[model samples]
Target: MAQKLKKNTAIALGNFLSQFKAEGNTKNPDVLNNNLFYDDFTDLIALSQSHNGWFTPEQVYFAIRSWAEALTEANLNEWLSRYDFSNVQPKTVGLILAGNIPLVGFHDFLSVLISGHKVMVKLSSNDQKLLPFLAKYMISVQPELEESITFVEGKLENFDAVIATGSNNTARYFEYYFKDKPSIIRKNRNSVAVLDGNETKEDLIDLGEDIFRYFGLGCRNVSKLFVPKGYDFKLFFEAIYQYGDIIQYEKYANNYDYNKAVFLMSLFPLLDNEFLTLKEDTSYASPISSVFYEFYDDLENVKERLKNDEEMIQCVVSNNLIENSIPFGQTQQPKLWDYADNVDTLTFLNKI
Candidate 1:
């Protein structure tokens, strides 16, 4: 039964996701032909904001498109090729999803299914609709998945292993509770960028996408920066002006105003461009609509610091300054194999 999981099924799922990428209420012709799925998608777009204020139609569509691009037959095969599932036994894998960004847990869902494991999903209240709807689509494409998926509401039990994602505090509880089970307990992590002052204006513009997308809510977003001493901010600010419209959203505007006031009250100097604020702080987890920056005289020292604090960091964004750092505008656009925290989920499932 496990080997019956076919690559064509993955491609069909990708094609289904591709239909919802267009911005606004428009639907692809193929999607419109499926009456039930089309109705569900339209309702998803309409009610997403009410479910989670950050889940605007645009952001949800962005998430859908990203998954659509990743789930192609070639991408799926490439990602799965690294793992040998020849001896995978069907065990139930429990998932505790996060709701920081729209469909944030879809990657885990996809990983479990493709690896030939039954998944018991406990979705975050903030992100309830999208994944389950897609799960229905998956069952429609491959009926075998219908018997392997379950969504729990109260407590997570009756599973062989666990893969839980939560904050550092909740992680402690997960560690204690799942002590007897083979598990992957994820904790809080944030991404940072290294700037050498030699980057082009275009690079800075793309970097803005890394910061503002998802309203700086996802773990992959660059919430901190490492800039050389005396780096000029004039060009960076000018290039990121296109995202200034973010302040128009009331939720983002409120957060920006509140965080900016807090900075001013603490007598901290900041570089503000009306919408986004940059403060000289050493912390990696900055609030919404703001990014924390620290000055560095030596790139090597910064690299050493990042190495020492690797667990606290998610992805590194740089223009060839930091080794293996993600390219600008690509922190959020991770490939199918870019496992979170660099922990291979497929291998974990195989062993469990």
Candidate 2:
């Protein structure tokens, strides 16, 4: 398929995606093939939570909206312009996707197809529906692309290269299994926020979005905090109190009750406000409904610590305290260029 056709098809898919929102599904008659896909996609959004209890309509809508925003013509052109697709040799690329978040592995799917490669995907059982449905829509837009995409039910084979995402244990297996192939193997990583005493109440409130979105299941969710010594929690708690309604969700409430009980039984001191818990710990990965925090006496030391621990960290949200730190509440909203684990997916695709 021509590169222009692929890009145009993605833009049309984006238009198709834009109609399904948390507020309601709007069928735009102008969008291509909407008559065929619009109702089905809307029903999928409504039924997603049944497949995975965490896949609520609101969370699924947010993921779809993010993709719709990313697949615009300008964004696609700017992202693709940096690479030379000329003289590209088409190869089959295998993908083993992760299912922690809604559409978590779509970027890899998009990367393989956009880079002029055939993709044989082994979908995570937890996220089996959304991407394959989108793939069908893409094929509808450009029939030529139907041959370039395949969803495998069992083990993947006949691939020149592979990309896989999983937990740390699964990553070990992936590394051993695909060691000979040119690959990008992503393991566990967690995002953290660095805090100073001077941040406004609004800033802390916005940080709530970073913590609670997707029920804190995604690698990009802020799971830890680096706070200055002697900082008070009163203001921070008050700022984030607006998001306490999240605890009302059945799954989140169950997690909150269970995790809080476990922590209490373990005799770990925690600061709680009914919905979320804050514990002082050194670990970056936190349990659902909880956030681990560490105190630092100096800013310079925090920068050194983050730099040395960059591999275990996905994103560092800060108020410009560190160089290249992401702004507040933007960890989940990664730009096309903001590749996962700081490894450029396009660069990997362009080479393989």
Candidate 3:
């Protein structure tokens, strides 16, 4: 089974990579307008957008390859070594995926697959095509996985365990519906940045990726920032505005215009642009909200506030402040070693 999974993953990854040069080169303007998985051209655009700017076809090809490499048996074995799954066997696991970002629920899917369990995946309508396409490729490589994988469009029942991701509102529904089952029902989480006022313009530009990637739709996108008192907003805005082309999305432009108006009406100060909005706020979560910045007079005092809101926070983006934080641009591109909410995913799978 391990060998089959490895071979299949490799073949599927190769198939995806081959499509890039062939389908990605067609220059149809209409094809550039839709979301990923609707078509090959749109999928290319989505990949480029998620990367914070334009990505070369080769770069997109390599990124998909990297994801497949992580699914190999050797990699899976190394990841699972930290957890004791010897006696744990789950018959069925239900997965409710969030489609806010591309392939955001993939890790959970991989966890269920490599842990020797059957998966009943309920994909988000927004991202219905990619998972199934990838699954079909996998099955093409290793036909045995066909029996273990099932894609459903409606409610799932009789699963031994569940792993669901959604907004804070949907969490209540998940809690009530899956209360009797062993589950991990995730709520909303926002990432933040702590700037020490010593950062270079280059650092701020990279930090922009954490802020504006996918037009700030992903949970990993940094919505709020903590800067030293008297930090200059001018330099920050200048650095991030290089990726102004993202505003070309009509939906994103409408969001920016709407949010800008709301802030102005409320007498809130703002930094305007075709793509992003910068404002001042205390909260970390931004929903079509601008790149809000808050000044911290004392670093320790800010740390105390962050500790209080850890549940609402995902990761802290900084240079080298502490153990839990990552580098500025590394927010959207999470390493396999970085587990969600610091939960031991393999252990969670084993317990089921």
- Candidate No. with top TM-score: 2
Residue pairs clashing in model 3 are none
Against the unseen true structure, what C-alpha lDDT does each candidate score?
A: 0.89, 0.93, 0.72
RMSD of 2: 0.8
Q: Give the per-residue lDDT digits (tens) of candidate 2, residues 284-345.
A: 99999999999999999999999999999998888998899888888888888889999988
All models, RMSD in angstroms: 1.6, 0.8, 5.9
User: What lDDT is reached at residue 137 by model 2?
Assistant: 97
Predicted structure 3: lDDT:
0.72
Best by lDDT: 2
lDDT of 3 by residue, 17-124 (tens): 333442444333342122343375346445654443323333344445446445555655566667654575647899999877656787787678767788899998
Ranking by TM-score: 2, 1, 3
Candidate 2 vs 3: which has more TM-score: 2
Per-candidate clashes come to: 0, 0, 0
Model 1: lDDT to the true structure = 0.89
Model 3's TM-score against the true structure: 0.84
